[model samples]
Target chain A: MYRYDEFDHAFVSARVEQFKDQVERRLAGELTEEQFRPLRLMNGVYLQLHAYMLRVAIPYGTLSGRQMHKLAHIARRYDRGYGHFTTRQNIQYNWPALSDMPAVLDELASVEMHALQTSGNCIRNVTADHFAGAAADEAADPRPYAEILRQWSSMHPEFSYLPRKFKIAVTGADRDRAAIQVHDIGLHLKKNEAGELGFAVYIGGGQGRTPMVAKKIRDFLPIEDLLTYTTAIVRVYNLNGRRDNKYKARIKILVHETGTEEITRQVETEWQAIKDTDLKMPQQDVDAIDNYFRMPNLPQRPEGWSQLAAARKADASFARWVDQNVTPHKNPDYGVVTISLKPIGGIPGDATDAQMDLVADIAEKFSNDEIRVSHEQNLVLPHVAIADLRIVYDLLLTDGLATANAGLITDIIACPGLDYCALANARSIPVAQRISERFGKPERQADIGELKIKISGCINACGHHHVGHIGILGVEKKGEELYQISLGGSGDEICTIGDITGRGFSSEEIVDAVETIVDRYLLVRTDKEENFLATYRRLGAAPFKDALYNETANAA
Target chain B: MSVKVLTANRLTDGEAVWLGANGDWLDHIDGALVARHAEAVAALEEAGKAAIKSNLVIDVNVIDVEERGTNLYPLRLRERIRQLGPTIRLDLGKQAEKTSANAA
Candidate 1:
């Protein structure tokens, strides 16, 4: 929870006023669409299919109760009473009118939030592990560094107009919940042997038409040289990245063309010159940012252990929910509760205005006013006491938020494909919905185990389909929707791009096709203990591909 | 040649609309002015450009359509989804309004 100082408040307010003036000019026909497009995109406003979309950044997916309440208010007032939480840990309003964008931004600025850099060719919202502060296994909270990077990159003159949109992710844990491997720059925060914090830096990773796992450029970059080293890497790409073709514009393409060793050498050379400059972070500045994120004082709640056991014993439903949706917190007395946005047959990552309001209330009362938007498209109550789990669960159940299917087959991640996106070739929501419903049964899903099904509308990979245990990509072919399935992909410590199974399936055949892979996986897996990803890795694509296409091939 | 119609999202609100026979934008594609021949298609394209210049619309295009019975259907799924709201959410877009209108 980084509070905005006077400078931060003034900066955001100034941007809002500037955007308001621009909006007025555009509405008055003083500027053409072409002239206004880039300006609007910089402010996170885009002309989507049915209406304009406003993407608000939730920096490192952190939010306060007041900010969440304000978001709900905006959704109720300016939008259609709901917002879609995207894979990048941002929230997008689908039906905000272009005329109302200025007012909407004004409301956002009131909270310590804005839509700046959510779109455009600037460094996008820097994402980190959702369980940054609360996770049991983290080396250090990554958000402090993320905030530092945010401060450094916000309106930075040199890197603003890169060849393409850039994304950076950080994770303090070895688990890689932030999907750092698929971003333009991935930073793994860790403590070396001497107990001094540093980062293992990976560069040129991206997911789009061409999905690439980032190359580890630096094994241990000192924490003091974070900004200077990052500038060096981005400087190298900015100079050499292709602007000739938009498809070939990302740093991943440049990295592919230039060998990793040469690129690393270039970055190190650049870093040597600038590492001693003002970009070098001082110890006091790092501590200043870290001070903002210090953990809340928690009096030992020893009674919660017995209380939680009693609650679990009383309700089988609650027991199942706790098993699935809750994860271990840094403090033994507390548990991190994931509010499943993916209800059976419901839209993934969508929270209605009422639902958002309810979550705010729950956060304020029980969870110390902290809420997190997971990159997996779920909300997190990061510091709920183990004893208060039942109460939080009950409040969430009232709003249909307590589905208890985290990391299960039904816990899907999807992009707003043809439904809202003008860039989409086919619909992703319906396909996700159908698959969720097919695997809706809890026992069935538990039997299938931890299977991630990520769907993208197009090859942009906004849905992170490239890293799904079972990835479904929808494309347009001969005026009809065709879904191409890719299996064995994962976004973890051992990140790997999925391999396509075979020919694509039509919309009608897609759900069944997914079911075929799951069923095949069930048959091949040694036991229930082995997850879909583990099974897929153990036995390659041959079995799944045979399950998906062999019957059709034989019939033909 | 397949039938065609000029369409765009209104500049102010970004609501999807189509050019009607009366040189006005209609919210629903049912009332859109269809171009059967090359001359009519050219006319529609000109109207689209004029609409953009007038700041009435953005992202103007002439998309293919076919008449099935009295209903107009877009040839491409993208345009079809645009003409009607998202297929997944029946309660959203123009389809919901149309349903309510028919019910009334």
Candidate 2:
């Protein structure tokens, strides 16, 4: 974890104080709601359906145990005893008083965290693969470059208020766990044939009303030009992006409206103008940032941890949990444990105050004092020793954090739809809850295999429903809530926006529709190993569509 | 004519509050000032403006409601959640508050 220098401390403290003054002015009737809307938004405060939401950034989804503890404290002290982890790797406190925001921000600053770019039109939180440095297939840790980009974009004058929000994601591995394809700018860090570090840059990808997979703008951008090239891309969009309509404002819309070749030409021209300037970081600065993300020292592991194997053999539930929630680490001795936030019949991505505190304790005691928030809305102990897995599992189990369903049917990603969002047309949480309970059986979920079920209340796609293996979008139809299902979507290396299967189903009919589709896939799949996504891709959405709408199947 | 009620989140605490007959904000929806006619809507809006001026609440707006006999119910599902609480957690929000009060 990177420690904040004196400059960082001073800068954050000043911003907190400034926000405090602004909030005071707003509360004292010095500023109207219209005047204060942008000011509050810039500080990550949103006025939702019934209350306010405060979104806190977890840069690259990395946090220390101490920071996690502080987050728990915030949830306990300021919020409604819980926080919702979002798809962008941020945590949103759904209820916070306007007067208390400055104090909350001050507490966050103490942990070297701020909500600054979390909600603004500026470059939002720079995210990377949750298993950034720990994944087995990573070519290089993407966080160093992410951190550099974070530093460069924080309060950058030129790009602060673009046509709309801009997002950037980076991945170190060929397996795109960071969902780089669905970002405004997606950087794939790789070593070229000559062993030189560079990025395969993709631009103008986004998921919203109009979803797009990023186009490859530059095949191999040299490491030195990372900042300069990124600036060029944003500059092109900032100047040319449409301001006439808010819906047509995102960079992805610009790329879609303007031909990719012409946009590439414009970006190249802009890059040529700025490549030699101070935006290009020197070698020493890059090296300094890279050192902060280096793997922590851990003692070498014994060949096989017999105790872990024995525990698995002893307890079938523990074995199921390990199989579902744990991923292989880059270091063979250690394991990355995902703490499922999705409990059956519970709100997805929500961790209670007590659970947060307990997870923080577990991180401190057994997992090298580091924690990560995955984009899938689960928490990760990225460097837990395999030998300590049982105890860590036990601790999480005691607090209801150890749900044995990760990447399974129950690990749902959902936005706070009509439940909390002012913009939502219908409810999402109840639908997700129903789905989780329907597939609550560990054996059943394991049989279903790695299925991604993402739901959103509206077309904003905050839940990344556009990329779900089974995407459910809630829409209002004739004063009733209807769920529109899309299949064959994926946010991976094989990035594709899902195609809508057919007519939407009523809320009552949706869960059954999902189950019907799942059942059809189960019967149609060659083997259980072929997951829902793989089966859908292989056979296409026709079978699944037929299963839902066919009167004969419904009768049966 | 369709009936309506003015609702807003309290500025200080962000609790869901509704305009009352006495020109006050009430936490529970049962005591809300339901306006059956257009004139009553004007009165509720006037009270809402005063509340805003007093910094009592933010984002004040009217929502459609149905008056069944004497009891009132919100028409839109979103407003119902606001009046009650999160559908997922019955034990957590205003619904719990109402339940506990009735139990007592």
Best by lDDT: 1
lDDT of 2 by residue, A58-165 (tens): 999999989999999999999889999998899999888888999999999999999989987899999999998888898999999999999899899999999899
Indicate the residue-level lDDT of A83 in model 2: 93
lDDT of 1 by residue, A1-556 (tens): 7999999999999999999999999999999999999999999999888999999999999999999999999999999899999999999999989889999998999998999989999898999999999999999999999999999889989999999999999999999999998888999999999999999999888888999999998889999999999999899989999999999999999988998999999999999999999989899999999998888876678788899899999998899999999999999999999999999999999999999999999999888899999999999999999989989999999999999799999999999999999999999999999999999998898788788999999999899999999998999999899999999899998999999988999999999999989989999999999898989889999888888778878567
Q: Top DockQ: which candidate number?
A: 1
Cα lDDT, all candidates: 0.93, 0.90
**Stretches of model 1 off by over 4 angstroms after superposition:** A552-556
Reference contacts preserved by each model:
0.87, 0.58
DockQ for candidate 1: 0.88
* Model 2 steric clash pairs: none
Candidate 2 local lDDT, residue A16: 98
In model 2, state the lDDT of residue A86. Answer: 90
TM-score of 1: 0.99
